[model samples]
Target: MSRVDSNNERLMILSDVTKVYPMGDTQVEALRGVNLQIKSREFIAVLGPSGSGKSTIMHILGCLDTPTSGTYHLDGAAIQGLNPNELAEIRNRKIGFVFQSFHLLPRATACENVELPMVFAGINATDRKACAERVLDQVGLKERTRHLPNELSGGERQRVAIARALVNRPSILLADEPTGNLDSRSGAEILALFEELHTEGRTVILVTHDEMIASRAQRVIRILDGRIGQGSSDNHGRKE
Candidate 1:
């Protein structure tokens, strides 16, 4: 959450990162010596299939999990050894997450759902409402602010979810399978919205199994069997 990168240059750095899980009598490696760097305003995609460890990378990038070994620096501050509370603060204040499921409160109105993050962060009701409304407008859901999740279409619900993610104005937008639940038309619309956000200078990191979806990003890093793949095979098989 602290802005250690005063030069405003790099946003994230990972060096020889690894993650291993204890599974009964055996150990499972989810990440293997991953090294990566992300600058502010970059749009990146972690492209992989199930069990390829892309999600683990996302979790580490979002500060939801720590690397089992190696270092991770965000905003130029080393984060590998931070406590859970510290990590939670970082996740809440610096990372905006979009999941395959819309993850909105079923009973809350769209505006209220978007306001939830700020509410937890102790923002006043007035400010939360205003910020939520503004982001909803940005995501093309201004008129549907009062609609509940069940009252809106699939695309509209996802828009509300995105509005919530943007309300924090976090340092990075990390999306995991963001378009997985939508139809092709709606998914394309969502991708366009993300493009618009990237244009506005937000750091966007998309994690998805679909190669076509990853192709939309400016850069793609493929993962396979818990390790970064060696590939000149860029998005959609286009050479970079």
Candidate 2:
């Protein structure tokens, strides 16, 4: 079991975080004083309307984009001023991301697509291949490892993406609209996979506009106008 303490074992922390974008002479506030804590093995949903800054929060958490102000700590390391290379290293080592569009290289097979991140991190051929194959099998994509993205169904492609995300064995899996492009059946399959991962002690943070999808998470954070709203829950699907 993972111990919870400020001194150790916290998977993610965001304190008074804000991201401001320069729009001509003015600034657009993407995230306003957002404060959140995500512990190891927690399944969280950051839910909000389209412009509510959930995207900004996701970007910050994934290390894909930096906040304009405030602090973010991942596994006890302060990450506010880390440079691109450093951030990339952290992203590769600690964060796994699944986006709605299923960002797989068109020319690559499922196994090859899943191996991309590990490749960038300098994992050798044998180990990388093994890791990719293992994760693909775990995600129920073993039979599709040789298939190209176009050859697979939408759900299959998404599963491939999930396998790719897990190939690096990241402690935190950050998914953005993971079910957005899938049908209800596919979406539910994805949610079930998330549940399985959560049960297996992975920290899963999912961002989505669908309350139904958000319902799967144990915690739901509703954001409005760039700040957290007045709602909170471990039962997001319950009647409002």
Candidate 3:
């Protein structure tokens, strides 16, 4: 288990985190000394324009990439210097990621896609299958469990992806532009689902450029030019 403190108030922390990308003789800083803290069940939005480092933050939060410098503690464990395999293990065990593109298996059904995470965790066939079915139903896809990516509508496919993300019961649901490719109605539906998850005490961190979507969260952290800007939201929120 991660080294949770007695108070157990924080789920993740980043202290002066920085990420630099190699660009020939020069280096581009993607994240610049970012400091953030997330509690166990807070819903947050990391909002910024393209190239503003929100995506980099998302990658780091999801354990898809580590920062070039500084510290990150997720679920009370220090994650700054973990090896690739260790990072992969942490990702599989603690983070559930939903991306802009639904990266479902082209040949698999919805339940099969949802079961992929458990397969990596060495879950037995019977339990994994049953869990997949239950989560798919939770995401409002009970009737579409057998549908292939090509057979489902965009919204349904996104819901399947959400189901896949939830199958492992991760500590955090990290989404990157989850409704970016959907129509207004579909996007609203997906956002509603995110809100539902938040209401149920799940930790949700959404990275998006859409202000409307960001507004739905309880707190919003604005990133600008690879640095955190002023007036970031507190626990109390910014609006009525």
State which candidate has the highest lDDT.
3
Q: Note the residue pairs that clash in candidate 1.
A: none
Local accuracy by lDDT, each model:
0.88, 0.89, 0.90
| Candidate 2 lDDT over residue span 1-240, tens digit each | 123355436678999999999999999999999998877777899999898999899999999988888999988898999999999999998888999989899999999999999998899999999999999999998888999999998899999999988888888899999989999899899989988987887999999998888877888989888898897676524522
Total clashes in model 2, counting residue pairs 3 or more apart in sequence or in different chains: 0
Please provide, for model 3 over 129-210, each residue's C-alpha lDDT reduced to its tens digit, 9 standing for 90 to 100: 9999999999899999988999998899999999988888887999999999899999999999998988887899999999
What is the overall TM-score of model 1 with all chains considered together?
Answer: 0.91
* Full ranking by lDDT: 3, 2, 1
Give a tens-digit lDDT track for model 1, residues 155-238. Answer: 898889888888888869999999999999999999999888888889999999998888788778899988789771333234
When summed lDDT is taken over every stretch of 10 residues in candidate 1, the lowest stretch is 231-240
Identify the candidate with maximal TM-score. 3
Query: How many clashes in each structure?
Result: 0, 0, 0
- Cα lDDT, model 2, residue 39: 76
- Clash pairs, candidate 3, are none
Of candidates 3 and 2, the better by lDDT: 3
- Return the lDDT, model 1, position 174: 92
Candidate 2 clashing pairs? Answer: none
The TM-scores of all predictions, comma-separated, are: 0.91, 0.93, 0.93
Task: Compute the lDDT of residue 215 as modeled in candidate 2.
Answer: 78
**CA shift of 7, model 1, Å:** 9.2
Stronger candidate by TM-score (2 vs 3): 3
Q: Candidate 1: what lDDT?
A: 0.88
